[model samples]
Target: MIKSEIKKLPGSQIEISVSVSWDEWEKYIELAAKDYSKEIKIQGFRAGKAPRDMVEKKVGTGALMDAAAQRVVQGTYPKVVTEQKIDAIGKPQAEIVKLAEGNDLEYKVVTSVIPEAKLKPWKKEIAKVNKEYEKKTAEVTKEEVEKEIEEIAKSRVQHVDVEREAQDGDNVILDFEVKKDGVPIENGTSKNHPMILGRGVFIPGFEEQVVGMKAGEIKDFELTFPKDYHAKNLAGIACLFTVTLNKVQERKTPDVSDEFARSLGKFKDLEDMRKNVTEGMEEEKKHELKEKRRGALIDALVENLEVEIPHVLVHEELHKMIGEFEMQLQGMNITFEQYLIQIKKTVDEIEKEWEPQAIKRVKAALALEELAKEQEIEIPAEEVEAEMNKALAQYKQIKDIEKNIDLARLYNYVKGMMQNEKVLEMMENVK
Candidate 1:
């Protein structure tokens, strides 16, 4: 049997003073002796075959007691936390206060836990937000549908080789190099780079200079970068560019017609295409508005919430945010280290900058969790299992999926998500 005294500490931490009875301590000591005996060799016996008493004599009572204390603490700390209903976050810091040969084992464990949250009248706030947004409607105009069609038509455009001088809206391929004060600028040299004239992709006057240039023609010109250019070093600086025009192609965009609509799979005619595009736009707008309203509701709730967020939770959140940021950088074909170098900031600096947002996220999550409890919202085990099975089926092509994924942790995460969705839906229906 074990005895423990729990004391609440500052910063959402709990300190537990644990004492294990001598009888239990003795059992652990014997088990520890047996484990140590596995490595101890006796003169007349095979390796790890020595008796516990013999092993204790060889390794000494102090080592045996220490090992036993570790075992007892490791075994009891989790049970104490669970039985006490402590919502611990990170690893506990344990310190053995006493580990003697015959007396009881004593230890102290300090762990960070989820903090208590005091939420405002979130339902009333949510209802007000819903009522305000209820007056607005998502609508797609004819011009918006036409714009979508234009983009689709542009995707199907063809570029035909032309021997004439480059003109506005014509695709041009060129080789160019830029120099600042007779010294070449970094990343300013390109070969066979494609650019569409009048796109204003380059510096203001650079495209204009390429406008009248024909294939095989080379020209040298100087242009000044905009004062507000993103690269401060080059901003407002005049640079010389040596350009060689290699090719020009006229862009041919198809007109919006029934034939054009049919060419794009699964459309009966131009009118049908327009109808589908308008519907899609309307649905997208509705989703965007819904998201905006949800965000507003969450923001309102978080603003009124009172909770002392533990540092461990914030640290974990920061780690997650950094991982998400790294994924975003990867999507842009950029590495995290490269991004840091380009931005001239360290990871620590970035985390410090993002700390406020992380805190807001933590508060929002805590508020939602508290609200769920207040509302008595619970997720069914069957629903969680069904969702998990569905998710697993989607990944069936990956062999040994269980080996790669922690199914229990995944189940908890999915359950939490479903509960949050249910709670949010409840709030959304307040009006």
Candidate 2:
């Protein structure tokens, strides 16, 4: 195996150019043939049943040659980098350096990797936060539960439909058409869509338009979409909507009875349902409070951090956030393109919005890494194993993904994240 020094590039790229001798090339061919033999086919044999020589001939010299090259690069590149004590990151760009039988197998793999960073000194500033928070008692009081019950009960509360006009919080069934410049905006008209007043799910000020509309009332209103609206096309544009009330109904969420509790499934009575909901809320509150503390601690650490966060990592994190945002939009039956059209933004525009958050995450990661060093926070192998197992279980729906994933990469990422959690907790308690 021919070895070479890795070349460092901006944004975590480590490039290594290398060549293999004829012996090495032959070895790679054998390796590739073993991995790919089942797929090879040739004349005078069943599919994938040809002899090695026949398959190689049928597949063409070039195909086997390329495969041989890939085998050598894929197997040797990372091993060489590791042996040479060079850190590589992400997926490297592999290029054929040379290709000729009996000459040499040659290639270069450019990998993006996280660089070594200095750990920041743990300071006294973070200790006090933990102390103060520790002093505050966490409670899931009965009063709070009762309050939640009352709020939910209000939704199902019996109400008389007044002859007057419907107001905010009153239910109205209506048909509406939205238009721009006297022409209907695409997908802007609705008939008998069940809309709840005061839900706030509509665009800002949309729910307000329905308030005070009496039965048989026809209302036309023009409003401007907020510039920051999730949809691009309609963002910051004023449009007109024509709404006609088809019916008015008051909500009575079936009084807090046994029947109502059973309707929701799994409750002995109203009190049982309230208790369960309260517990759930209590857990949610605890999580939220913990998150706030963690966020504050991370903020502090990043504020004091010193290091160059790889742009690659920032982009990766940003991409994850974008995927989540897109998923949420998808759940609402909106595509990313549709969202862009509605908000009048391209994917790049969406990316720009998340850039700041990405930077913050990267900074926090660097700070946490430093903090982890200072605190000697070591993630146990068992923890990494457990994390991997969990991830693998989730990969069942993804074909070939379990095998294709680079486990070392996943382990490092998870290990770093776990250490960061410890670092944040330490920072939160730092005085």
Candidate 3:
């Protein structure tokens, strides 16, 4: 006979225990050996043809036993959850609780799950938000556009001139090589490389060393690398750079005029440019105001609705954010594991740090979701259809996603979310 139990743990975690007799463990060993047999490469035997006893002797009872425990726990976990009516969301962390040769195999699985929190109603507050928004202006004026046009024209023309010494914020052209303990790091020399002064794009103190150096001058600076520097070989070590300043130039802005305005390509005149600028600025301001107000509304609703978040959802969001950050690192040619190493942080440590922010995000999402429910607020079917058609029309030329997606559901979800956000914004403005 086998006994299984789940223990509720602190921090919204649970521990599941499964204890089975030695005979049952042996049965699992036989089952698992078959599944993993083909992949085992054994000398003097064709793969998958080795007898279970022979395999056990070759890989040892420990290997087979471990595999058996894995199979037993994984196979039983879902059943336990179903039987208990437990709604688990993420992967459980499994550990061996009891194990001995010729005895029962026992293991425990621990994991974070969701919390049960209720949401509250926010409609009465929504009206005050809307009234405040209605009182405020969402406008685009001609004067604002004219000022933008003038600024754009003025910025279009830049004055460049040779300078004797590289000043702060001046653009520097140089050939630089950085080394720590006499070892080269990343492209030792670059010829006429465009370097922005004071950007800290180079090793710490590199730009400061270049400061006041004239064209055709050489300088060397020593600095300590950041304690947690990304380069493994350079972290917390002193480094030096041999830099040869090739040239220096100062940047200057120009005055706005009709010719500067026409540089923007086919602007009939300053007046026409100014008018277009004003209209665009007004539209942008309105969009920003709409978003700002919407955020306020959601915060109010979350507090008003009194949301209780699921722990599983918070971890899921944290994982998602971590994934996004890792993707950005990927584009720069480094994996998240590599980044973690650079920061000197273990994955668990970083995850723990992210939990608080993740919880907040989860709470906010649930609160808005609940408000949507309490109000019976929804995007009309017609609105969903229109949004879908609009999206497809906008991305008609894109392949794969645009062609294969279920436009209706995606549009409805997006529309529902947008409506909820707007409603929150309206609430904020009212009071």
Model 2 residue 14 lDDT score: 70
Rank by lDDT (best first): 1, 2, 3
- Order of candidates by TM-score, top first? 1, 3, 2
Relative to the unseen true structure, what is the C-alpha lDDT of residue 305 in candidate 1, on a scale of 0 to 100? 91
Task: State the displacement of the C-alpha of residue 383, model 3, in Å, after optimal TM-score superposition.
Answer: 10
lDDT per residue as tens, model 3, 1-431: 57778888766677878787787666777776776678888777776777788788877888887888888887777777787677676778889877676798888888666654566556666666666666667676666666676667556645375867888878888888878678877756677798878888876777888899999998887888887677766778887788899888786655566766677786776667776777678788888887766765666666675544556687689888898898899899999988887678998999899898787677777676665566566768777677666767777464666668876678767786677665564345454
Q: Which regions of candidate 2 are displaced past 4 Å?
A: 26-71, 82-87, 98-101, 104-106, 125-159, 164-169, 175-191, 195-244, 249-289, 330-335, 382-418, 429-431
Q: What is the C-alpha RMSD of each candidate to the true structure, in Å?
A: 5.1, 7.4, 6.5
- Clashes per candidate (backbone, < 3 Å): 0, 24, 18
TM-score of each: 0.78, 0.62, 0.65
Candidate 1 lDDT tens digits, 1-431:
78889899999998999988888768887778878877877678676677877887899878887888888988888888888887988988999998777788899999999998898666677789999999889998899999999999999999999999899999999999999999999999999999999978887999999998999999999999988675778999999999999999999999999999999987999999999999999999999999998898888788779888889998999999999989999999999898886677899999999999999889889988998998999999999999988888997564589789998999999999999899888888897
lDDT of 1 at 227: 83
Best by lDDT: 1
lDDT of each: 0.89, 0.75, 0.74
Model 1 lDDT at residue 286: 98
Q: Candidate 1 local accuracy as lDDT?
A: 0.89
Choose the strongest candidate by TM-score: 1
What lDDT is reached at residue 325 by model 3?
90
